[model samples]
Structure formats: C-alpha cells, structure tokens
Target: MIASLSKISSYKSMNPIITLSPAILGALVVLQAGLNRKVASQWGLSAALLLNAVVLLIVALLIFALVLVKADWFSNTIRPSIDFKTFSIWFLLPGIIGCILVFGGPWAIAKWGAAQTFILLMSGQLLASLIWDLKVEGIAVSYVRLLGIGFTWIGVILACKWK
Candidate 1:
C-alpha cells in the first residue's frame, strides 16, 4: 500500500476560500449551532457550546493558508519535487494522530460525554482534511469545496444527541 501511494506530479486545483474554508466554517457553525440549539448539552454549555470560536477561527485560518499555498504550489510548479516516501512520513504523523483522535478519543478521552460522539468522529475527519488541505483527485488547485453534506449530517446527528 505504501509503495502504491507513489505520488505523481498530479496537479491539484481548487477554490482556496470556497472549498476548504466552508468545511471549517461549517464545523464552527456546527459547534455553535449545537450550542444554540441545545444539542451540545452533552458536551457542556461553556466549553463545548460557545467557547471554541477563536480556536476554530485560528484553525480555519491555518487551513485556508495551507490550501492556498498548496493550490498555488501545484499550479505554478511543473511537478512536486517532494520525495513521496519522506513526505508521506511527514503527512502520516499528523494524519495518524488525527486518526487516533477519531478512533480512540471517544472511548478514551470522553470529550463532553459520549452523547456527542458523532461530533468527535466527523469533526476529526473535517479537521484532518482541513489540516491536510484536503482535495480531490482532479483539481488544478482552483476548486474550493468539501463534503458539506457529510459535515451537515454529522451536525444533525450531534444536534439530535444534545441534551
């Protein structure tokens, strides 16, 4: 599987602000909406509901910057000069950490109780995608959109789960 991931200079183009930003924004809204709608009560009124805006905003900015740079880099450059093996390792570190949070954090850390578990899973995936500047296979770095539906569904589930 690792060898199969031998990446090519595949061009990635997507809307920097539109594609990835919405995912982040939507997630923020989810957290906020969860609070407003009393769906995040399982988590808490203070920590889970209205407190994460600044943190999420910073994350959004980071995702925005990463997507923008990646889009431009792939666009202006002929091909990626990065070594797949080494670069994969770099990517894997964070990705694996994210995976751990998604899979293990629920049963382990117990963030805001288990009622908000769906949020844990979906938000983690969204964060992972955002952090990696998630993109599909065929964009020359001009497309900017993510799985809005996925985020919405998770948000809905969480909204339901709220106390």
Candidate 2:
C-alpha cells in the first residue's frame, strides 16, 4: 500500500497526460460557459441547464458504453467489482456541486460578463483547492505555492478591473 501510494503521488512525473488534463478542462470550461450563456439567453436559464444536463448524461452514457465494449469490461471473468460499503457519502458532493455550477454559471456570465465571471470563479476555485490541499491532504504549504496563489489572485484582479 505504501509503495502504491508513493507511485500515485509521483504520477504526474510518470504521466504528462494527467498533468495536462486539468489545463485542457480549464479551457473547455471557458468555452462551455460562453456557449451556455448563449443557450440560456435563448431558452431561459432553467431550460438551458436542463438541456445541458440531458445532453451531458447522453454523452456520458455513450462514452461508458463504448469503453465497456472496447475494454470487454463486462466479460464473465472480468466483471468490475464495486464496494458500496467502502464508498464515502462525500462522494455525492461533487455531483451536487456540479449541478449548482451548471445552473448558476450562465447566470453569472450574463450578469457579470464572461471574463469577470470566469476570473472570479477561477479565483474562488484556486483558493478552495489550496485550502483542501493544505488541510484535507495535510500537505505542507510552501512559499512557492503561496506565491502562485498570490499571482492567480493578482491576475483575477487585473482581469476584472474596470478601466
């Protein structure tokens, strides 16, 4: 277990894809936020968010089906094992938070403009993530990490500043 934990901790060095995925997600979220804003303007926020959730559910189901087939994941001898007892109730939080974000994101962009909203969102996310890392993960807070957070806040401020 210790060996695997060490390996997992060093996964970024082993897999560049893992490190780059979040950056790609950040770009996609910006585009998604803009597209969602347009959809909300035409259909109203609740309808737009409902439509978005439905589309997302369809895509996810399709992807899951494709992966299952490609990997032969449901083969008799390769059945996936799930331990419901070991699963934390906290696992539900992300889905709930995601729903809230999907519902509120377009409204925020409409009210605050995309750039300001995205900057504010990013700022909050960065701070929350830093706190999670430091407290929940028991990670040491370093000067460099603090500096990066400081720079992120500065960028957010500049992005949202009025001329």
What overall lDDT, based on C-alpha atoms, would model 2 receive against the true structure?
0.82
- Using Cα atoms with residue i matched to residue i, what is each candidate's TM-score against the true structure? 0.27, 0.77
Number of the top-ranking candidate, with lDDT as the measure: 2
Model 1: per-residue Cα lDDT over 13-94, one tens digit each: 4456655785787566445444433423465534432334456568878866776767765554543456766655467686
Q: Please, what are the lDDT tens digits per residue for candidate 2 over residues 47-98? A: 8888988998999888667667776655554443568989998988988888
For model 2 the local lDDT of residue 112 reads 91
Q: Distance (Å) between predicted and true CA of 86, model 2? A: 3.4
For candidate 1, the lDDT comes to: 0.50
For candidate 1, the per-residue lDDT at 95 reads 51
lDDT, candidate 2, at 118: 81
How many steric clashes between backbone atoms does each model show? 18, 0
Evaluated at residue 1, the lDDT of candidate 2 is 56
